[model samples]
Target: MSRAKGNLAEDKACKFLDENGFMIIERNFYSRFGEIDIIATKDEVLHFVEVKSGLDYESAIQNITPQKLSRLLRTGDVYMKKNSLDVDFMYDAIIVTPQDVELVDNITI
Candidate 1:
């Protein structure tokens, strides 16, 4: 997808998360490993969110391959260590489609 479209989806994802009571901490956090799309906190746990958009949920979700997940994990670790954070955290994904935005939490590698 184009960068513009990705940003739009991320903007929508941020709105969705904010409305759901998550406090947005950062966006596009980059490290040598990769980039994390969004970082938020809710109920004292940190969320590392990856925004994926497509015509449907399955198509969008499929974009998060194993290699991509590994990158996310490594980047998340870099984020925590760099910030000196020791809080609970989990990898997540936000699937944005024409119909709605969905959050899939606790994504595993």
Candidate 2:
């Protein structure tokens, strides 16, 4: 997707998260490995979130392949180390489709 489209999807995802009571701590967090689209905290657990949008849920979720997951994990580790955040955390993905949004947690690699 184009950068503008990606940005718009990310914005929408952020809005959805905020509405659902997630406190957004950061967005577009980058490290040598890759970028994490959103970082949020809820119920004391830090979330490293990857945002993916598509015409359908299948495509959106498929975007997070193993290589992509690896990059997100690497960046998440960098973020935690840099911020000295030693707390509960997990990998999450927010899938935004034309009809609805879905949040999937603990996306273990």
Candidate 3:
């Protein structure tokens, strides 16, 4: 996707997360492997979120492939180690389409 679309998606995701009670911690966190789109805390658990936007949910969700999940998982590991976070965390995705945005949590690779 274009950078503009990605930015829009991220912005929408930030708003969605904030409204859902997650305190924003960081964004666009990078590691050697790849980038994590968003990081936040909900209650005591940390969330590593990926923002994906498209004309529809099918196209949006299609972007999150196994390879992408692997990269995100690797980056998540790096983040936890760097931050010395021993609490709970999970991988999540915010899918944005023309009509609405949806949050999918604890996604498995």
> Model 3: per-residue lDDT, tens digit, 22-74?
99999999999999999999989999999999999999999999999999999
Candidates' TM-scores? 0.98, 0.97, 0.97
**Clashing pairs in model 2, backbone N/Cα/C closer than 3 A:** none
Model 3 global lDDT (CA atoms, 0 to 1)? 0.95
Which consecutive 10 residues in model 1 have the weakest lDDT in total? Answer: 100-109
lDDT of 1: 0.97
TM-score-based ranking: 1, 3, 2
Question: Residue 24 error for model 2, in Å?
Answer: 0.6
Model 2 lDDT per residue over 5-24, tens place:
89989999999999999999
Clashes of 3: 0
The positional error of residue 69 in candidate 1, measured at the CA in angstroms, is 0.1
Model 1, runs deviating above 4 Å? none
Point to the candidate with the largest TM-score: 1
* Pairs of colliding residues, candidate 3: none
User: Best lDDT goes to which candidate?
Assistant: 1
